[model samples]
Every structure is written in structure tokens, then in C-alpha cells.
Target chain A: MTHRVAVRPSGVELEVLDGEDVFTAAGRLGYRWPTVCGGKGTCRTCFVQVEEGAENCSPVGPLEREGIEALRRPVDGLTRLACRLRVEGPVTVTKRGVRRRVQE
Target chain B: MMDETSEPATARCPGPSVQDYLDQDSRPVPPALRYERNDYLGSEDIDTARFTSREWAEREMRQVWRRVWQFACLESEIPEVGDHEVYEIGDDSLIVVRTAPDEIRAYVNVCLHRGRKLRTGGGNVSEFRCSFHGFTWNLDGTMQTPPCAWDFPHVTPEKFALPEAQVATWRGFVFINMDPYAESFDSYRGTFDDYYIWPLENRYKSLHIAKVLPCNWKVAQDAFIESFHVIATHPQMLTWLADANSQYDVMADQPNWNRMINIQGAPSPHVADSVTEEDVLETFYDSRSFYSAAQGRDLVMQEGDELPAIPPGGTARQVLAARMREQLAATSQQDFSQTPDTELLDAINYLLFPNFNPWGGAKSNIIYRFRPNGLDPDSCTAEIIFMSSPKQPGETPPPAKIRWVPEDTLFADIPELGVLGPVFDQDCENLPYVQQGLKAMRKPGITLANYQESRIRHFNQTLDQWMSR
Candidate 1:
């Protein structure tokens, strides 16, 4: 089963499969997401503000929490690490200020 | 600002912090982890002719360049079968290719038919087809097709197989030797296993930068072999690097190999009298914090922040290293948890033969290779490769394409170089000046310090030995 993930502002919708992370889902649909840590949840560069449907994403893992704390990036309860957020149902999110640098 | 006797100051720690954490089973470093060294090198006048004279360079191309085992490319660079890299030295270019799942082959990159250069750069190809004449050879250099078969009645496929060179691998580095009867690579590279047995194969090349330097290859290579120049050339490092006190150990039994173990998190012995515990703390905190920030980690310190307190019973170096290990464990899935403080903080730099300098470590481990720009006495190709341990088993990072920076380009333009850019920029600035000085100086030779520049002396002796052959 696939759930619709609507990226706000861009209004791009991606059909995220079960157990697929939001970052991977977005990447499949030609949406660029920063993956500095190669999606290990170590680098907080892959964060996205979940505008709605937090229930669709997986509960924040230990690594995700540690990343958020370590990076000192304040995230509201709705903010989800795109690399860590496994899509469960329909969701809406906006990409945070993160883009892959050409050199990196 | 108060008088010395009035207040009780926080006592700085001594020795390594992680030493206390080690139990009986894992405290002692095994024999495999150690490298042998001999510090017996006599001071000798290194002839300036080797650097400035084209005649010497010509002789070196035939004798030294062909004879010595030189780094061709990384095995990771051509991971797929049929992928090849054209490694050129002097007038010779060898196509180092992966022919099978496990086997790698190297052949002179010249077409047998018309002697046209088969390939210029690196790429994957099922067979090497000459652009000039369409003469083709299999990945293993067996002649596959001669365009218009009737044109070459005298040439048979069996007899026209491309000539091959001796190829060997250490860790992930592919080395090639052109000499028909070169010594067994094991015997030739006796120092490599003993010194860098640190699972270097587990690391993947993440960055590569090459630039043409206006200096002899030997001069560019020699600049990096010793830390003594850090005092004069990189004076800012005087606050951290133990330049004078740094141990320069040479394996006199081994040819053209030496290791310089520079003590980091300490001031240079040149200014030992002025060094204080606070200076050590500041250096450790600043360098570690800066390194963390460069790696996409949040700043461990802020502007005007107080230096981290040295842990009890630990020196500043150990404290910083221990914290770094913790940070690494927390940030990355790669388990460096087993690596001891001694190996983690060890700032040992090894110079292997003609030109390969690699420091021991996972992160911040930089490898340098210098080569003559195809027999140019006044110019050399300086390559810098940055590597880190693979995050997963059998994981290979993408082969970083060599970014050749123009001489006029600012070092600041390449932010991926991290802190190394400024340090290398300084060396690049001095290389041309040194080259010009070598030509203009009335002195027939260069004099090296007896103890400090022993690596340079050892290297010269090895070069002389190779050149004699």
C-alpha cells in the first residue's frame, strides 16, 4: 500500500510505500533532499517540517533524537527527520533549509 | 589577575585518559599493530643537481622511476571489471585495468599497430580500441581484432598481445613497476605492513585534489616528509605541533621509508619554555571543535567559550581524543569504539619510497603523492587524497575525481579540502620560490640537519641506490 506525501510550498506529491523513509520517498520522485550522513540520522541536514499528519511517520528513534539534540536544531513536535521518518499513512511536509552541495 | 599564591588553580591532568579504561585483555598493542624503526642516519650533503638538472631527471626516469614501485591508482577507483586508469610516469603510461572479479592487469597504454596512445584518461571499456587505427585489444590486453584482418599478414593474435608490467596491491592502493625483473612486491614493501597494518583497506577514498606545482617532484615530496619546516613555514602550528620534540624514526634496513611521529595537542619544543597547560587545553579544544564543525557537526564550542576542562588523570591530548571518539560513536554508525587513544590521536606521518605520504587514522587521514610532470624538472604533479573508514562492511565510496586547481585559483574556492587547504596553500606558495632558489644558489648541494631532517637524508640515500642500479 502507498500513502500520499505532499511536500508543501512545492505542492509535489509522492506516493510513499510502506516502511520507506520520507527522504527516500521524496528522492524517488525527483525531489532533492540533503543526505549528508547518507541517511544514517547522524546528520540533521535531512530534516523537514511536517505540516500535517505526524501519525503517518514513525516514532522518533534514539538516533534521530540524538541528532536533533547534537545539531542543536530546535524542532517542534511536528518536525521530523526525513531520513528517520518512515511513512505509515498520508502526510504533508516542507523541506528544511538543506541542499546537497556540489562539492560534497 | 590575582597573585600566584592566593588561589587554588585547577590542576591539569597527566598522561592518556583512556588508559584507565583499558583492561588486561586489550591494553597492550599486539605485535601486528607496531612498526619497527631505526634512527641511525648520517648527515650528508644532498646534491642540488638532483632537483635542478634535467640530466639527472632523465637518468632518474630510466633508473629510479622504472625500478621503484609507484602508486598507480586506488583499487576502488576501478572497482568494476574492464574499468581502467591510465597511470603515466615520465614518458610511459600504463593502463591499469581490472580484467576479472579478482585479477587486475597493467599494460603499456600504446597500441601495438601504429604505436598510438590507446587511452588518455580512465573509463570502463570491454576492449581497448585504438581511436587512431581501430586496433583493438581485450581487457586482458589480448589482441581481439586488427581492423581489416588482411592488412596485417605478419601479425598473429598470439604474438601481438600487449606487453605487461608488474602490478601489485597494498591495502587499496594499486602499485605498478615497469622493470622487467622487479623485486617481489612483498620484499620491496617490507615497511608498509609493519607500519600501517591499521585496516587501511576498510577505508574509502572520499576526496582527491591534484595540482601542478612549480618544483621538482623530489622537492615537493621532500617538503612534506619532515615536520621541521612547520616551524618556519606553518608558524601558526607552533602552538600545537611538537615540532622539535617530534620523533623522526627511520628503518635504516628498509629502503626509502621513514615515519615522523609528531606529538599533537602540545606546543613545539622550539618554544618549550613558553608552553603552558592552558595553551595545551586551548589548542586541543580549538582544533577538535573546528574539526567537528568542518565535518557537518554542530560547533562543540562557541565564540569566546572557555576551553574544555582536562579530565582528571588525563593530558589535554587524551581528553580531546577521548571526547572525539565519543562524538564519532554518537554521530556515525562506524564503530571506532575499539580504537585506543594511542591509535586515535597518533599523529604519525609515513613517507613510502619515491612519493607516498599517508598518516594513520580514520578521519582526517590525508594521503599525498608527488610525481614529475612527465620529465619536467621544474614542475611536478602534487596529489592529495582524503580518506575515511567505510561506514559499512564491503561499502565503497564513489571514486572522487581529481579536481585539478589552477595555479591562480584561490584555495578558499575549494571548501571540501577543510583545514588542509590553507596548510597546502602555504606549501604551494613556497614550492616555486624553492625551485627558483635551487637554480640560483651558488651552493652545489643542499645541507640537511642531522637529526630533524633524517627522513630527507634517508630518502636521498635510497634515490642514490636506485639511480646507481
Candidate 2:
């Protein structure tokens, strides 16, 4: 089963395959997400806001919960570890810390 | 260099270097095994100007850096899929990533679209999306998407995969070769099959230090291949560093391997003064203290005000080994009972051609790597990785990021260096001075001691082979 994911601002529609996490689906579509620890759920650099259809995503795993809570800045409960969060239905995600044109 | 007034280069016990150590107390195969010298390398003169010449550095960059297998990063650094690290050599940058649970891949960090450097440092990425124009690539280097795909009619995903390099792993170190047709890792590291007998894959990097030094990479590397400088640069070590009695083995068959076995608990012959048993014990305590520091433990020595007498037949090496085993067992809570005494008591520094140095034995805990800084012949980055036996099986902690020390930052400022800080500080200080001295020298090149500096000579000879190619 496949679900649709809409990337905010860029207005790009992506097909998120069943069990495919939002972070990976976005990457599959060439929407680059910031990740320092890759998809290991260690670096937590891939945090993203599930602005719409939060219930459509899989429940947060332990690693994502710990990472989000440990974050220095307070984050909304809907913010999930993009690397660990798998999409279960259609959703919209707003990636934080991503800039279209930025210097490394 | 050993003084003319000192005794001959032979070890205290006779026979082949390996048999001599085995005869002592049934030790394992010594790091410095039976090895004959390559006469061709012995007579060749090394040009001192190579240290400061721009043309020579460029040639090395083209012929050596591009062609040789260089240490990219440790496998432990990127244990999970999508984990990557950027390794830059000369002007090229490579992104080493874990494509699967067990497989690692290397790709040129340049975006295939416009050739902009794709990544700078390291991080996890689902796919490599170039920040400039949003040209993205999957972890395996396949083009995932390109901005305005319909506008670029000529660009096809099949022909535009990110360029890749040859990657291989030895122990837990990930190595990359930029040359597409370079020789296999085994052929490149010929005699290294017997170089590390102990388990190297079991260890993980606990401390990662990278300091920019003002010297050619070779100059910085030469400072470490031999223990001759221990007397002058590390004066405190004169009491126990067997500088003159150390075994220097050169591999005639293998151009990429050499070893120096610096026996601990013995006095440097260059000191010319008789060392007391107390002095020897002090040196042992120093080593114990340092090892304890690495494990975040403080060792309290049992010695009193007066130095204890040496047990009738006991040598400093034996006494030190016994004490170290007990201390390590207590501090680390691990059974070292089966570990051999020789591995605990000796400083077995082994070098691979180009720039890979790993000290041998269970007690050995540090590895060093040197590389030219960008294109500058007068500057290089010296990386020191401190490793320890795993406290618990399969529980090795993740490695720390590379701590970059400034030009003036004291080694003591870095907690990870622990007790070895001063020794590293001494070497770091001497490299720049040596680089300056080379610049001032009028002679073709300085001479090397035949017996003690054999490894340095072998390294330079192997370097010339790669440079000539």
C-alpha cells in the first residue's frame, strides 16, 4: 500500500510506500533532510514536524522519543524522528533546519 | 641516534631477534621477527629538499596520495546505515557511507550536476541532496532526483551516478583508494598478514584527536618511526625506554611493513648511567598510571619512601608486567590472566607505508595517522586515535568526534590524551623545528643510523617507490 506525502513550502508530492519512513520517502524523492547520524536515530538531525495526518504515521520508537526529549530547544510533541517514523497514511511534513540555498 | 660510546646494537640476549625474546620466557612471536635488510634501500640517499619542495609535494599528491590506500575512518564511526564521514585528501573530498548493515561505499563528494562539493563534514543522510540546486543522490551514489528534471533533456540517471572509489576494511579501519584500477588491499599491504596477530577488530576508538602541525607529512611521520629521539625529546623516558636495545626489523620482501620493539622496564643505553631498581619501578608505575588514566581510574602505587630491592632473579620487565596485569584486571574488571607478559610489557610500534601506525600488544592502546594538509607541503594533520580493550563484550561506546587542536593549544587541554599528553606534546613541538631545520640545511639530506633508524629508512625508500611510480 502506498500513501501520499506533501512536503510543505516546496509543494512537492511524494509517494511514501508502506513501512517507508517519511525521512526516507522524502529522500527517495530528492527532498534532502539534514541527518548527522544517518538514519541511526542517534544524531537526531533529521527531526521534522508532521503538520498534517500525525495519526497516519507509526507510533514514535524509543530512540525518537529519547532524542526529541533530549533536544536542547523545546519541540512540539508532533515532531518526530524522520529517520525512525514510518508513514502509515497520507501526511504532510515540514522539515526544520533545511534551506534550499545554504552554505555548508 | 645511539652514541658512538655506547655498546653494540645487539639485544642483551642473543640469537635471532624472535627466538631471543621467546627464549627469555616463552613469549609470543615478537613483533620484530627475523627480517633481512634490503641492500638497495640501505645505500640510496634521500633528498632533504623533498620536505620543502612544492613540485615534490604535487608529485606525491598525484602519484602517491591518489594511488595509495589511505585510512579514511573507522568502521565503528558509522555503524548504522546512512552514516557517513567526509575524508579530504589534497584537493579531493570523499564521502564514505554505510550503504547496508555490513557494506560500506565511497563516493566523490562532488555533486554530479555542477561539481560543487556535495558535503562538508559528516552526518547521516537518507540521500545526498546537493544544497546548491537540490540535485539529489541515493546513499549508493545513484541519482535520486534532479531539479527541473524535464528541463535537463540530455541528463540521464543511468550515466550520472556519483563517481566512486575502491573501499576496503582491515581490522575495523575503513580505507579508500581514489584510483579506480588500484591494486587490491591484500596486494597493497603485502606482509601485513603477520603484522597484527592480536585481535584488532575487537577494539574501538575511544579518543579521536586531529592536530594541524607545521611540517611536511613525511617530516611529521619520520619523527615517530624510530625511538632514537626518546632520549632527547622524552628525557624522562631515559630511565626505562630501551632506546638502544630496541629491536628494529625491516621487511626485505614487503615494501610496506616495518616494526620497532621498544622494551619497557629497561634503561636506555645512551643514558650511560646505572639505573636503580627503584627507578625501573617508577617507570612501571608511570605506565600503570597512564593506562589507569585511559580507563578513567587513578592508580595508587604501593611503593613506600624507599625503593624496594629487585627480587634476586626478577627483571624490571617481569615485575612491571605482573603489576600491570593485576592493575588492569582490577580497574577494567576483565580477565587478563591469559594475556602474555610480553604483550603487556613492550612498546611494539608498527608502521605501514604512507601513513598508518598502530602499536601492538594488548597493552598497546594508541594509533597514529598523518596526511598532508590540503596542498601545503609545509603543513600536515596528525591524527591520534586512543583505543582500549572493550570493558564489556559488544558494548564498545561510540567514538568521539575528531577534536581539532589549534596551533597554540596545549595537549594538556585535551582530557582524552590523559597521561600521554606530555609525550605527544613533545613530539608535536619538535616537528615544526625539524621542518625549519630541513629548510635551513645546505646538505643533500641528513644521515640515518643503520640499526636504530631502519624503519625511517624503509619508509623513505618505500615513499620513493610510490613517488617514482
Candidate 3:
């Protein structure tokens, strides 16, 4: 079953499939997310604060944990790499610089 | 500011770091990694004319190329007395020959009698006999016969010897200097020997691919010297390469040489958020096949071969490096059990100034040489030498003949380059346009990433410094 990811501020909602990360779903849904490594957990720029449905997000894996630890600032329970987070249910996230492809 | 007894502290380099991956290596890493970093050159766009101006290229040929110790040929190429290879650089032709079992000498290819080139090709020769006038010189470059014994009364052995270039051998690689009074090769090389750990003497030139590129020599060279181009030029490598996190070192001690350590077998931060361990491993399978073919070594994997999956917590680097160690330990006579992942898996690229690139690694040790393609200024010849480990320890195999492909033929069309060819093609395609774009762009210069492209700036700075003299 596909879950809904609501990117805050931009209000861009994405239908994320099982085993798919949040960043891929955003691109698949015609949205551009801020990134240098582009979905690689290395840059950690595509990070989000979970505002709602925390339990629905996938558990942080080793890769995501390493990336979070490398962040300059301290992380709380809501902070997660958008590229590594997968949702099982409807979730809300805050991300800056998210945009939809302009339709011609 | 208050730590008086400790080493001087420098500013921290931000962003994803190669040191993080080095700390992740399961095996002991190279001690060379402990050195301090150099200051940034500057945040500036270098002049684009270096790639397009004919006058700039001419100045480089006279100023830079004339004075540097250029890598000519390997000692194994001329192990026997009288074995010779013709090395052609910008407007200069040299005959590198083994004068004795232990001595190698480089002579100006032109015969003293006339301007005709004495040797057309490399092969075993009793002497260099100019087919034009039959003015012959022995293997030692001493004048032997003048064809007509009584015709010339002014010829003497002392004045008649072939004009020689300064030649030096370091660990089996022969380097030649066109300037007779040029500084000794040891001094010109600087502290490169300190960090370079690979001993090339035990390797043989298994494959040599020389292609004439349609851009200035430095343009072709700048495409390399950094992994910054991987995101656009070699996207296939991103799944297993750490492009942004790779280390770049520019030091005052080794002004003539600069180095970079690109961590292979790991996902580039560019794709790190989305790529998984399986995806990284998958790409390696494809590249590993081609890398083996390029080296003419037995394929580490065959068609339908099952891959050992990356373990639950293990990295692609750890898994692949372990596999390489197993392959080397089995096939090679030397002990590879203790070789670190950095040596076996990292792309340790080093540039010996002007135009020679000798990589440091236990495997995938390739060499690149770039020179102006016959004074065109707009064209260059780039050669890649795949250095392979000998079948038996301490044994040297005959070097492969340099294969020159047509300028228009894509590197992908070359059977030996395999998948690496397309990556090269991407680099080649951009060069001509870059040469033309540099001429057409409204901007006077192009900006560079202060940290990533520091190598390019270091080289250009060095070139300008040399040219001003």
C-alpha cells in the first residue's frame, strides 16, 4: 500500500510506495528537493522535522544514523534524512526549497 | 590560541570528509593520511584562455615542457642492451635506449649528419643507422661509420657523438629532460616519495591506449586531476564513488606534485540518500568486469557468477576490498593479506607536474601522459597505461605497444576500455566545446569550487609561475 507524505510549507504531497524513500517519492511526484549529493545521505541537506505521524516513518538505519551523527547541530526525535525515511502511513514533514515542476 | 605545547592548529575543512571513510576502513590505513592539509589557493575563476589561446600554449611548450622531467618510457621496455623506443613530445623526438644492462640513455632522434630522424619505430637494434645517409651510431651513441671513410676529414668521435638528453631512472620508470642543465630529477620530484607507497617496479605495462584528443593538452588533463567531474561526466561511478567527500591535498613541501584520495566502493554523497548497499554492489559488478578486461587480468567475476551480498551492517567498500584481497592472495605471489582497503580500493591519483599522472594503489594503478599533439595548441595526445602486477613476483613482462585510435573514434568503441570508455567519451565530448566555449562565453573566467578544484588552481598557479620566468 502507498502512503502519503505531506511536505510542509510547500504543501507538496507525495504517494510513496513500499520500500521507497521519501526523497525519491518527492521527485517522482514532480517536486525538486534541495540537495548536493541528491538523495545521498552524505550531504544531509534534505533533512526534515517530523511534525505528525512519527510512528509511521521507518526506523533510522545505520546509514541514516551515521549521517545524523555527523550533523553539526544536535538532533531530536523528529529530525531525519528525507532520503532515508520511508513512511508506512500518512506523515507530515517540514522541508525548505521544495518546488513543483512548472507546467507549460 | 592558547595551546602552546601542541602542533599549530588550522581551520577545519567542512562538508563530507574522506577522513570519516578512512576511519571506517577495517584494515590499517596508510600512514600518509596523517599529514596536515594545505591552505586554499583562492576563490577565483581561472582565465579560460589557458585552454584556447595559441600563444599561451606556445609559451607553455617553451617554458614548462622544456624544463620538467617528463616521463618517457619504462625501464622494462628496454631491458636488453640496444632496445629502443621513440618518444615524441611537443616538437621534440627522443630515442630512449638501453645502453647497457644497467644504463638507459635518451638521445635526440635526429642524426648528426642530417636532420632526418634516425629511428622510425622501437625495436632491438645493433645501432641507430640513418636510412637517409647511413650515418650510423653504436648503442652507446658513439659514432661508428660514416659510409665513405675518406670523404669527411673533419669528423671526430668526441664531436660526432649523438646529442644526448638528461635521463634518469627511478624505480624502473625512465624520465628524460630536454634541458641539459635542468635540476636533478630527485629535486624536481620533491617530497612525493614520502606519501607514495606503491612500488611500480613489480608491475608491467599490460595495456597502453593513446588517443588524440581535440583540445589543448591541459584541457584533457584538467578533466582528470580531480573527482569533481564524476557527478556529471561519470554518473555511473556515483553509485560506488565518494565524489564530494574525496580528499584533495596541495602542500608547499611538494610543490611539484599534488595528490587526491577518492574513496571507491562507497556511494557518492550525491546519491547517498537514495542508493542502498545492494545498488552500490550492483554497479561494482559491472565496473569490475570492465576493469579486469582493461587490465587483461582474469575477470574477478564471470557471466552468471553469483555475488556475495553486502552483509547487513557491512559497507560496499569493506566487502569489495575483502574480495580483492582474496583474489590477489590467490593469484599473486606477493603477500596481500595485510594490504589496506585504502590501497586496494581507493583511487589515489598523483600528478607529477607538467604532464604525468601515476596513481598509487595496489590494484588499478594506471599512468597517464599528456602532450601537445604536434604543436597544434588546439589538440593533444592523452595516453593511458594500465600497469598490472607480474604473473610471478619480481618478473617483468614485455610492455604492450602503444595503441593510437583515430581522433573521432569514441573511447567506448575501444574493446579494451570497456565501460570506462564511455566515461572517457563524456570527458572528451566536453573538451572541444569547452575550448570553443571558453572563446565564446561572455564571462572572462569560470569559477571553481575552492575546496574540490584546488588541484586545478594549484597546477595553473604553478604553470603561470613557471611561464613568468
Cα lDDT tens digits, model 2, A1-104, are: 88997777667677888888867777776666787545756556788777899888887654466568756534454788888887778888886544343346
Which window of ten consecutive residues has the lowest lDDT sum in model 3 chain B?
A: B1-10
Number of the candidate with higher DockQ, 2 or 3: 2
Q: By TM-score, is 2 or 3 better?
A: 2
Clashes of each: 0, 5, 8
Which stretches of candidate 3 lie above 4 Å from their native place?
A1-104, B1-15, B149-151, B287-300
The DockQ-based CAPRI class assigned to model 3 is: incorrect
Chain B TM-score for all candidates, comma-separated: 0.88, 0.90, 0.91
What is candidate 3's lDDT per residue for B312-423, written digit by digit as tens? 8888788888887877766666687888887877788888888779888887478888888876878898898888887678776788888988887877787666556777
Give me candidate 3's interface root-mean-square deviation.
27.5
Candidate 2 lDDT over residue span B80-131, tens digit each? 9988999999998999999999999999999888888877767776777675
Task: Tell me the native contact fraction for each prediction.
Answer: 0.00, 0.00, 0.00
lDDT score, residue B419, model 1? 54
